[model samples]
Target: MKNVVIAQSGGPTSVINNSLRGAIETFLSSGKIGKIYGARMGILGVLNEELVDITAQDPKQIKLLERTPSAGVIGSCRYKIKSQEDLERIVEVFKAHNVGYFLYCGGEDSMDTANKVSLLARERGLEVICVGIPKTIDNDLGGKLQEDGTFAICDHDPGYGSVARNTAINVLEANEENKASYTSDPVLVIGVMGRKMGFITASARLADPRREMPLLIILPEALSQDDYKSNLEYITEKVNEVLKAHKRCIIVIGEGVNVGDLGILKDSFGHAQFSAAEKSAEQVLANYLNGLDRKDEKGRARSRLVVSGIARYEKPGTRQRREIAYVSEVDLREAYEVGAYAAKLALNGETGYMATIRRIPGEKYQVEYSKIPLNVVANSAREFPKKWISENKVDVTDDFVKWAMPLIGGPLPEFANFKEIMAPKLCRDYIPAGLREQGA
Candidate 1:
């Protein structure tokens, strides 16, 4: 029987585990696989010999894995493998257990790791089929967009729809809150996730398709580290313009904006991670406004910044993404179908290919899950398109809205605002040797 090995990595999204569930269910229904194993905490688990056999898990429990939030189940790690020893270790593990089919679910870095492992396994005389399932709320993989030349493989990734919905809706809700507090608060600044991409911030446009609201959306891609002063001055002018027309305004900042200038922490991939960034853009923007001395219509000095941060990861620790009830049924189906297609690639003896979803050539919204060489994907990094942005950089063009509107699928998934839900957290708590020594 062909043994299946699957691993998840990178940031958690709402429907990430649904992809895992799809992989597990695909194997469960197949007679060709003997055991389905999950590498604990992504590829790091394999290097550490930590593998969980989901094949033996209860069918009901396996089903719940789809709706479960976070990498809390198999666990996840930020540990990266770059050395020769790392590659050798992965090859040995695959050979040891006959892990012929490997499915990797994560963002770019995870895809790179899976691609490398497939090659290493082949060198070790093991025929391993490796396929990648694309995911990320950032929606920054290589998907097709119009002639802007900057596009990702996904039209709107699984997690992006929910986040876009949340961002747009929150902008509207924050409008209500700010509207009520306008006497004390004139501006509302919100921080959103999207390390180097503008997709998340652009989603804010969905809230105001008519452009009647006095809103400004900021994306990291639209500014540079050195543009901090100019950016602030620019925003200040816009705020004044909005205030002239309306009593209150909403501003959205991408979390990674000016992170380099603010001294932020970076992951092993040299990508700026939100937790590592010393000060968030919200904090910086708020501080900028607070530090400045502005004047009202009567030239009265008013210096204050009303800002708050909304984390994308709240529980799986990625908020609202996997709030199962909040998950877009369309997104869940696409994510699951992506996993199932990855399984088919592995089963068909395809090696070193990333299973990517792409829209068909017609004018319709049809998509087909297919395979692309990981080498091509690993080499290219898709950024936010320039044409998608207006000259003012305050809003995304209508072309972007048309490209993104379909993925949100009309509206967000339904959920009770205060309803409490809990998944079974596994009980085997053990600290790492280094942490244990430090009494962590």
Candidate 2:
């Protein structure tokens, strides 16, 4: 029986722990596996020689992981492996612990690290099998786009479904608030997670598939930020147009949208930490909309409003990824299956591969779990298809909505609405005391 070691990396999603649970359940039942250990804080834990005995944990607690959100059970980290010594140290640790099977769960950088560790282990004469389990809310970990209007390698990532649902539901709830407060704050700018990709931001459309709401979505890829001033002006112009027509507008903007300098901080992988930034994309856009960024030659405010209200903003931050209440049924199930598949791969002596989800092309939404080379996914980042972006760039196409709808499991909860009934006027028109005293 060969001992197995599992580690989770990068930002966690609502269903990330289910992947851990899936792998553990698969490994425990396998007679070919020995001791099961979880590396604390991802690969850093392996380097620091801190491994938790997953096999010794309570069985009830193990089964409860299906509902557990995030990576708090074991832990996770953003520590990058930048040197050969680090890889060598990882192999040394595995050899010392008699760990013959290594299962890693993360996004692109983690996959790259797993690929490197697998090669080095073989070179060092260690009979170790390393497999990658895909986990990212960004939905950027996939191959090239196919002619059929779907991406290859991986269709969508495990964490993405839940985040997409979160974005959609948040937009739905925000719409009610915007409707109530539009008289004072005509524009509401919402910032959602998605480092550079537009997938999470695009999910806002799911709340209004009929396109009846006064909603605008801004993807980082949609706007050319070479000139930040023009970008802000363009967004301001678009918001005013919506304000002019609807008198109220809700804008869902990706955190990576380059409205202006956000003073962003980066993680160990050099990815921007938008939540930790001095400014946010929504804050910058709100300032532009409220006329704070634009001043007349006389130093007076040159407001961008087509209506009589200021623009407000809100950021969901990390909440978009780890909210247990917003977890998608399909996302949780697929996350578990992907982890189980990776474990099965190791049990079958498969190496240098990562488990992926590929959508079956049809009217009825379906997906199949398959394998792709770790090196392939490691070297590529899937871009939101250009065809999916609407021509105005303020919205996504129905094609995108159709493709992502099933992953969110099912339709969202419907809210109540009051009928617009007006009371009959029986008295003469009268002005309020303040207005009558000031003018009439």
Candidate 3:
């Protein structure tokens, strides 16, 4: 029997701990593994010799991990291995700990890290099995587009379902709040977390499939921030159109929607660090709209029909990704299955592969666990398909709703509504002072 080590990397998710738990319990039951160790703080833990003996932890607490959200237990990190010295040190530490099997849980960058480590172990003649576990709310890991417009590599990353459900529920609640408060704040701009991809932002549409709400969704894939002036003008026009028809509007924007040079930071992988950025997409759009002079197509000042108040913005930040209350039962189950599958692969001597999920072809929701080459997943990225974007580029098509609706699982939270009949007027109608002054 050989010893095993497990570690997590990159951002935490509502179901990430469940995956860890799955891997731990599976390995323990296999009886082909020795001491089970957890690498604290991801690869950083390996470098610093900070290994936690999972075999010594309380079994009750281990079981609780099924409901525990985030990666606070063994921890996770964004540190990237860049040197031969670091690689050598990792192998040395692993040899000292008698670690023969390694399971890494995370997204694209983590897969790349796992692949490199597995290659290095082979080069150094170390007997080890390395398996990658897929996890990300962005759903950008890797995949091929199916004929039915679904992704094939992994139907969807594990954390995406929960976050999609979160966004849907949030939009439902925001609609209620917007309806009540739009008299004062006519526009509510909600900023969601999804850098470079629109999965998180597009999920808001799932809240209202009938297109009943006066909602506008802005995705980074649909708009180009390089031409800030034109982009701003286009979005302003869309919002005004919605306002003219419905008195109030709700805008959902992705955090990565190129709001033009907000002093963006970069991580080791050179990906934009939106969290560290000074300004968010929603804040920028709100400020721009609030400061506008209400000009017409001729660039002349005009009195708009429903520009009652300035737009208010909210950036939920990490709360969108880590909130346990919003987790989907489907996502939690898949996360655990993938983790266990990775353990099974390691025990069976599989190496340089990632545990992937594929949605079965059927009317009912179903999925099966499989494996894919880590190199392929590490080098590829799945983008929000352009065909899914609406003709106006401000919304997603019904096809998108069909693809994501099943993942969220169960009935969405419902809101209350009363008869919209207006009360009879007691006095004669008169022109408002603001409209009169504008000479309308």
- Strongest candidate by lDDT: 2
lDDT of 2 by residue, 280-303 (tens): 999988888778756888876666
Evaluation by lDDT, superior candidate among 1 and 3: 3
Can you rank all candidates by lDDT, best first? 2, 3, 1
lDDT of 3 at 382: 93
Scored by TM-score, the top model is 2
lDDT of 2 at 347: 92
Worst 10 residues of 1 by lDDT: 308-317
Off by over 4 Å in 2: 295-302, 427-440
Off by over 4 Å in 3: 292-306, 430-440
Superposition error at 265 for model 2 (Å): 1.1
lDDT of 1 by residue, 1-440 (tens): 76888998877777788888887887778778888899998888899989999988888987887677666888766667789898998888887887889998887777888888888877777888888888778887774565532244655566777677767777777766776676556677788888778898898898777786778888887876676778777776776677667756778888867633657677777777775555677766765565434666787535533332221211111463445555556677788888888888888888898888776655566778878888777635577888888788777888787777666655633322444578777988777785555344
Give the candidates in order of TM-score, highest first.
2, 3, 1
State candidate 3's TM-score.
0.94
Which of 1 and 2 is the better model by TM-score?
A: 2
Write candidate 3's Cα lDDT for 1-440 as tens digits: 67888999988999999999889999999888899999999989899999999999999989999988889999999988889899899999989988999899999889988998899999989998999999999989878668965587888999999999999999999999999998679999999989999999999999999999999999999997588767777888899999999988899999888767777898887888888898888988887887645666877544332476769999888988898998999999999999999999999999999999998876777899999988889857898988889989799999899889988878898768998799999999888787677454
Report, for every candidate in turn, its global Cα lDDT versus the true structure. 0.74, 0.91, 0.89
